[model samples]
Target chain A: MTSLVIAGKTFHSRLFLGTGKFSSNQLMQQAIETSGTEMVTVAMKRVDLHTPEDNMLEYINKETIQLLPNTSGARNAREAVFAAQMMQEIFETNWLKLEIHPDPRYLLPDPVETLKATEELVKLGFVVLPYISADPVLCKLLEEVGAATVMPLGAPIGSNKGLRTKDLLEIIIEQSNIPVVVDAGIGAPSHAAEAMEIGADAVLINTAIAVAGDPNVMAQAFKMAVESGRMAYEAQLATPHREADASSPLTAFLD
Target chain B: MNLKLEILNHNNMNIIINNNSREVAEGCTLERLIDEIGYKEFKFAVAVNNQVVKKTAWDETILYDGDKVIVIKAVSGG
Candidate 1:
């Protein structure tokens, strides 16, 4: 399987993990280790920079995992920008997961705000990875404005719906100049595998692993699934067929 | 009468705004008002409070009375 590279960092594992809703930090760390992820998404609000006993950072630090700060609560470009700046100061990195969903119900991204933020964040020297709809045009616009990556949701965040935007995702994969990391609503290892097979640079999972009966085991399962799918992709599976056909009699004239 | 005159002066500016209730004076530049609101620390885009104001232009543009001022933040993901 090909290594996923973003900003010169090579990641052998395409299964990126999220640090949220896990039963405990220990389990979260174990799951991350099992998943073999080098990068993990951590919500900006969850990080306690002042707390000496910050629990989450403890496990995360040992693994040497790169922390990707997310703007989960921000409602518009203004709030998002503020959160991003604060996160950068706290985390000491410009890498950000730009999210701008205003509505509390569906958590759908506001495209207008996302586009606006991308333009500004790029100027502010951020490696902006925006969470947006599966709109191909928006992706292109983000790229045009110098976003580092475009994270398109397969379904609503935490929905576990798994690749609802498969068709559009295919188009995005085909056309995108930047890496397409499929984030949100991935239900199972199979879903991660499917995304890998479709040429996603990476896949981020949180609720699926966190909510599993045994998160560590599930994390291992995801690890294997990601590898298996990536291997299959590299091997290039044969074209699918409908049914086995008997000797063709339609071309009997030529025979 | 002065408030009405200030409102009329603000209404004459070419900038677009999203929130008209801010009651900003006629000749106040966006930078001055943004500082006044103490929102400089918050990451945001100003639309004169409708049309998006580029960061570079924040200092140059002026706000008027009844102008809609839209302050937008970045948000996404459920």
Candidate 2:
């Protein structure tokens, strides 16, 4: 497998997992270990004083997998910045997945707020990965603002519609100076393979694996799919021709 | 006479924790507040009036009346 380097750190697996929507923490751990993802995202929430909760951090083996705490519920830059600071204190890792989507219905990332947060977070010494729409210009601007990576969504988050923004993603991938991680809306292994084949540096998956009938098996499948796609990309896929050229020895059967 | 003064102090020390009005003893620190709620065992971050209070500062950071304390921690997310 080819390596993915982001912010001077190398990741052998191109897959990044999200720690959410799992049937159980043990299952999530098993699936994560099965998938061999180098990084996983976790969100921040207020602890309910009434209920005793299980800390998911104990289940994740920090010795192997890096924790990427995200600012998921933050509606704007200020909230995001605050969350990022708390995440820094809790996780003790400067790596952050900056997501600012004010609209709850679609969870579409607010591009303006995302950009603003990225600038501030980057300045605060956080290795910022801003999730954004598949806009090439925005990707370029984010890169200019010192984002470690640009995570452009394949579709609306958790929608699993699969690469609704393929054309635009291609543009972003082509022009991006930093890694382009195709995050969100990847519903199937094929979707992951497609993103990898298109030269995406990596892909972040959540719903497809977490909500699967068998998430462990699904994670294994996704791992293989990502590897296959990346291999095909590295080997340089062959171009298609409009008309078929007679390259096969079909006439040899008669001989 | 002492019981009356203690009751009055408790009434005067009311603060909002996670948006719920509650009363704490006079000179209650952030550490004591979290310890009372059994959160000291867990890994969490606290913000007093929208400013993040580091864990090291929790011991000396005292809670005042009507103070808004937001305690947050890592949860599952994508």
Error of 1 at A112 (Å): 1.1
Q: After superposition, how far is residue B67 of candidate 1 from its true place, in Å?
A: 28
> Clashes in model 2: which pairs?
none
True contacts kept of each: 0.00, 0.82
For candidate 2, the per-residue lDDT at B43 reads 87
lDDT of 2 by residue, A22-65 (tens): 98999899989999999999988887889988888989999899
Candidate number of the best lDDT: 2
Task: Tell me how far candidate 1 lies from the true structure as C-alpha RMSD in angstroms.
Answer: 10.8
The list of candidate 2 runs beyond 4 A from truth reads A249-255, B1-12
Q: Global lDDT for candidate 2?
A: 0.92
TM-score leader: 2
Across B43-72, the per-residue lDDT of candidate 2 in tens digits comes to 888899999999999999988988999888
Give one digit per residue, the lDDT tens place, for model 1 in A176-219.
99999999889988898998888788888889998899999999
**TM per prediction:** 0.71, 0.96
Work out the iRMS of candidate 1.
9.4
What lDDT score is found at residue A118 in candidate 2? Answer: 94
Evaluated at residue A186, the lDDT of candidate 2 is 100
